[model samples]
Target: MTGLAIAFLILSITIVWGGLVASILFLRSRPEPAEYPPGGVDDHREDIGPAERDT
Candidate 1:
């Protein structure tokens, strides 16, 4: 491949792999929250919001 083509290929590879590595390291250091706030998917609170008023 031409020198310019090779350079662009390396640059693209570095960007993709670098981002992957950074994310892995970040998640490893600070994992996802085990417990989320209330009003999530399983929340059944009636006062959380208004009923089907269509406002």
Candidate 2:
């Protein structure tokens, strides 16, 4: 392949790989999922105000 084609292919692969890595890191940095007990209620976080609950 020509130099331009090879460069373009490499750049495309790099961009896609970078986006995947960024997505994984972003998701990993987020808070963990809520743990719900068998009672059917979620263990809410302190950040959630009382008004927000059961609404």
Output the number of the TM-score-best candidate.
Answer: 1
Question: What is the per-residue lDDT of model 1 for residues 5-54, given as tens digits with 9 covering 90 to 100?
Answer: 99999999999999999999999988966766886655667566756766
- Per-residue alpha-carbon lDDT of candidate 2 for residues 1-45, written as tens digits (9 for 90 to 100): 999999999999999999999999988997565665653456556
What ranges in model 2 sit over 4 Å off? 31-55
In angstroms, how far off is 39's CA in candidate 1?
2.0
* Model 1 spans > 4 angstroms off: 34-38, 41-55
Q: Candidate 2 clashing pairs?
A: none
How accurate locally is residue 43 in candidate 2, as Cα lDDT from 0 to 100? 51
TM-score of 2: 0.55
lDDT per prediction? 0.86, 0.79
